[model samples]
Target: MAPCPGRVGPGGAELLPGTALAILAGALLLAWPAFLNGYPLVFIDTVSYLAQTIVPEMPWDKAPAYGPFLHAFHWRMTLWGSLAAQVALLSWMLWLTQRGARGGVTPAAHLLLCAAMVALTSLPWFAATLMPDVLSGVAALAVFLLGCARPRLSRIEAVAVLLVGVFAVAAHLSHLIIAAAVVALVVVLERRVGSALRAAAAPALAILVLLGANLAGHGRAVLSPNGAIFLLARLQADGPAAATLRERCPDAGWYLCAFADRLPMDSDEFLWDPASPVSRDADGHPRFMGSVALVPEAQAIIAATLADRPFAVLRAMAGNALAQLALPQVGDTLPDTHLALSARRMVRDGFPPRELAAFDAGLQMRGLLPEVAAPFLRPHLPVLIAAVPLALLGLARGGREQRALVLAALVAIGANAAATGALSKPHHRYEARIIWLLPLAAMLALAPRRGRDPGLA
Candidate 1:
């Protein structure tokens, strides 16, 4: 019996075998866990999640500042359960991509897209983490997919758009930067400021909801400008001023201190100064030990640093992003390799108890396949560098245009690489999540068929 042409809905069409395969592949990857290890898998963000779980009432510092939605979820779920939430989020991304493909793509093409996405192993690993990275990634993908799927969407479709926008804001503050860029693109393409403003309602509403929730839950706006200023201040301060800033703004300084603070002085020498103007707690420890309260004066310093060293900042960010992409793991432990193994042994055997404990906990894990995988990944570096050109080509190809998809792919890759190079360790797993999109973009670029343009539809 020939299948009655499987139609989805009023405008929906039949599914292709390739699309099914892609979805199945994604599902299988999502379900696989045998090779996964719990201890090493838990990155710094996972530690933040653990802290949140243990102390539900603790206000979020900058580290895991995902707000009440994730916090609420973490409070209710165990570590494994939280990991499941990440999986669910990954599934959401897959589903959104499928739905977004719509008229512009055949079932087979859609499936191929999904398969390509699944091929990016980093996506699943990021999904497995307890951090907001998965949520932000899903949100970013959703925003792009939704934009591609419906050019002149109905009210109901707008609701979905609104949800994506809201999720973007609530997921992670940094994602808002990407979302803003996307909105600007839509504005330029649509050529209607009013329409762009209307489209932006979703994200705006999301921001409002986040603020309202923060106020309701914590009795203050979670990421108030003042709080940000204070945090920045502490980040810029040096020596005695920095110490005073830390003492005054413990919450804002907590995450910064946890991750930053590379000074060579002993904790006792710096932290236990009796004559210092900074205030101390009951134990004679600095009151702002864990806080990251931003101060106006410190903000001025950060601003000056940026202004004075803009190029350096850019270079550092770029370098950090590259480093992060090359690094094996984002966690706070060194990779288990011959060199790292020897170093770990030396640290364990020779270092003092306190120093050894710190070194073991602070060192980042290296990648298992960096030497082999990095070269294969390097070809995709062009995709990031030439994203604008690739996107233009997608646009030129017209109907069922893969330009937006390609753009999303590039954004994911370029942003990941650029960001990792700038801020975090370079790890292949981190790059793996978005790297497959590069080849997919190239494939779309090479394909001969001119399908229905997503923009036109």
Candidate 2:
């Protein structure tokens, strides 16, 4: 790998003066909540991760990375420390992506880009949050940058970026799928792509981390017991699961037969509604929601659905992908009852009372909003939806290395959309999480280059 222009020291060590400043600036900007509320901002999922951390258990719905990361720093300052780390990691990732492209950027340009992202995108909101949602975006960028420019990266940069990317995937099950999709896309395009192995590295590590974590935490190696139910939820939303339930009732011996007509259209409602059949057994304990039975039932129903109406299933998946790309909303940021309970549990368990109290007070304060932000930022929903194809087209005009950079971003976006839509229902967050890659790519495309590196190109 070729070193960044003017960055390699006598021993081939790359200097990161600008990246350090960017990291500092990003930490300050993203940690605004800690200044406001004496702690970092947290979401419903944040509590869940914290709770799992305290229990040292693998949760059915979430991956184990964020919880452990949070736990590692919780005793020091809880929210702020973890959030500070998140900001630092995110800053480095942005810097690596930029540096990986066209050699490297100046400290001022790196800081400016970080500022632009905070001011022009929803990055700060995500970076400040306790959820793993933001990491999904960071992982996408890392996968693209690493995949397209691995040969140009220093050993230290390569390892750091790989760890960050893998951590992102390990933080969320959905993100694992997203990472896998990006890797697969890179592999398919490897002839034109630079390094599919670089892209695949994070996802591969994520799987290993998941298995290792589950084994250490739960005395098992399985990923998530709840996957099947999420699939069943998506199927229920599309009608086939319910149809199969009705057809297979009585003789099929599944308990879902009795309430097949009452199934909800929305995935959340079906999966979490108190009255929904999936939420409980006859004894009122959680049954199909996260039970082992869900796997077989969901698999059976999906297989039957595809066998019966393959075209319909495909059409629904396509629609789901399109719907997932719609405009993101402020309401998407709101916490729910379940998440609130999780937060309270975390507070009751180990989070400092003072910090929790400050967090409650901070919720009353209007935190930083992007100076020039809107309901939906520039390029809009439709444009973002088409960003991949457009990016690929634009990349065609560039040299091979530049094209590889852009193509990785484009492929990551497409892969995220497809995986999210097919494996799970299309939610705005699914697309919004990775959508920033479009604008990020645009910025990189327009940034002043130091002339392409010979090795990568």
Candidate 3:
């Protein structure tokens, strides 16, 4: 084969100059967490994922891909292997995406841009963290590869892109829907601007994998418990769903009626709190409320509320959409609960005791850190909000293929925003997963100087 066919030129087996250095630079930048903390950083969800990896059963809501990957990495006694693997895969996929973009970029430029990402954006945070958020952004690049770079791809490159996209979808339930939504948008753009089914082949196969994985892991063929309950929880937090609950509870015989008065104003708090009606049982045990018995009631409330007050639902969605558009603050790192729970899980699962000791030792070194990026990234949400549309406009100024790429990114962001922002609730981490793409798109647009004219490029 042509030495690493994924990076090979048509002329010979030799890879692009500095390609290895660029990937190494990207990987080191992404693995900064491990370098500093002696382990990968984690979110609260990370504990559940770790537990899922060691435990026999799949989590009710979590997708199965990352959990198993973590299990495989745990054999080495620390999370460094998992973090390193994540950074390497991310670096490789990013290199492929940039290579396939318009004029392509020098490997030096790629390394410099990767450094910029580490410094200027939350790229390193998600990348180094033990969560699936980083993959969501990578999936966007895969979408572009499949949609705009198909003709340029060698067979190995095509397979790599398809696998990346599929794995991205398998990482999270919302990710699968978001990827599907982007693919749908690509299909529409192709119909309007002229592409081909070849562009969608990867995404189509990804959807099949998504369904199959869900079936295998959760014993269900659904994309994800239907998302109707979460949507209902969101509406409840926004006021109208609670109003509906109060009106229809006694006669309708729904469970949430009892606690409608005590529901939290925050969508995430309400949905995730142990005492919330969605997950709590009368006997005080945690219950999986996504069962068939609860779906119809949640669906009924959603249907009635929308039918009675359509404008209210739209207004709520808009508010959350705006919130999700803003970039997450840098201070939004893992909570103490995440560390404690993760450590507990490690001990319970008989993980290497020495690794846990090292982890604890690393914790003592925490102190008042220099405040450079956090101060600026917090209040500069407006800049981040403006960047996405500007990136799309910049892409439009390029050739036809770039315009299609722009559409694909827009749809991906829009669908993700709707799903995580409105349907669930606006959280920084939700949007952070995809917001890195705006800067990436801008970079790609500027890198192609020698390509066709702005109109034809």
Candidate 4:
């Protein structure tokens, strides 16, 4: 999109024609870890998303949208193409969001912003990642831009923002909830009900995408075939499900009556560990996301827990939500743990030999990513510590545009913590995915306003 008329910057600088070079440089900087790794970063969930290519059935654990997203960006050859596309999209969001600054952020200043994030935040790690984490931030930006920066955008940019927002929300279930919250805030604060509805339409569009994909691929029109399992896992991990199970074991007539004593395991272990009752077969093998009967049982358990012990469920969820809020820190963005192993094995099994070879050759697969990532991870907390207060100040005193962006970031971060922590598990990665927004919005809020555009028309 070209720069808006009457929107002035230092020396009356503009963008589109100007920001192209900066966007390119920023994209590379955003994906710096991948450049070092010689391959795009992979996560535990990367394989499941990649599996969408070959698997006919829609997975119960994750949304069906991201596998196709990776496919669309993968260029059919190397993942660097996907990484490039992801980071470029993120860079554009950063520039466009920053462009909402009072006079507008100059390309040089925008570049400085991206550089600061690469050095001090978790932006680079996710930007280069093959998973849907980068899209989470992109979705937040899309919500802010579509909801707050729409008038400044051309019809094309608006449509582009909507499409990007769809995939960003569709990439994960938690994203959908985060988007809904941001859209609501935009409506309430900006008073642009129409704009907020348009923003809300992104999640609607994302839902349609999942329905169409499921109908075409699996001959079913369901969204998230076993979505309740995530809730069940969360409740079980949080201690409510076990209490429910203990209360009504044999009479409940559920398959889980076989294992009521093993009350509350960690959500990850319940979902992935072979010993977990949710997934453990009679033969001792850990099945993928448990048996065919698991979803219904999971749903029943979740329902029973909420109905019987609503306070316990709510308290546990509240605790998990609070835990997640405090855990947006960047820890293990690039892993050397079992998650790394999962990605490695899945890539080897699901992808072509060449793709697997390149994956295996990456810094993570070589056991070097954690060490390489440590230095970059160190400064993130300190930067976030500074950014939170700046963002708060921006929300309190900055102009409407600044307030909207900062508030959107805060709402998305809070919503993400609540959703992922309460519905899935409280992990740093869940909140870390969207935490970069704080610094980005804070910088834009504090940016200088040189020109005459006071606010939107």
Best by TM-score, which number? 4
The lDDT per prediction is 0.46, 0.66, 0.67, 0.77
- Misplaced by over 4 Å in model 1 are 1-25, 31-35, 38-41, 50-54, 63-81, 98-112, 151-158, 193-195, 214-287, 293-297, 303-401, 411-457
Q: 246-289 in candidate 4: lDDT tens per residue?
A: 88988998877777777688887877676887677556766664
When sorted by lDDT, best at the front, the candidate numbers are 4, 3, 2, 1
What does candidate 1 score in Cα RMSD to the true structure? 10.1
Minimal lDDT window, size 10, model 1: 1-10
lDDT string for model 1 (124-191, tens) is 44554445665545544555554544442434544655675576556555555455555555565445
TM-score for predicted model 3 compared with the true structure: 0.84
- Cα lDDT of model 2 by residue, 1-457, tens digit: 3322423322233454544665688667655534544446566666668777576555667788888787776663556777778888887777667766656655676678777665556566677777888887877777766666665566677777888888898888877766776677566655443477778889888889988877776577877644777877887788777777777776777767666777636887877677567667656776643445566676676677678777767877787877765634333553333534666567656766776666555542233232213443453454455555656665755434455567666666676776677668776666666667676676676565664332221
On the 0 to 100 scale, the lDDT of residue 339 in model 4 is: 57
Top of the candidates by lDDT: 4
> How much is the lDDT of residue 270 in candidate 4?
75
Deviating ranges (above 4 Å) for candidate 3: 1-17, 192-196, 279-296, 342-344, 347-350, 363-393, 400-407, 450-457
RMSD of each: 10.1, 4.3, 5.3, 4.1
Worst 10 contiguous positions by lDDT, candidate 4: 4-13
Cα error of candidate 2 at position 284, Å: 7.2
Q: Which sections of candidate 4 miss by over 4 Å?
A: 1-17, 54-57, 101-103, 281-291, 339-341, 345-355, 450-457
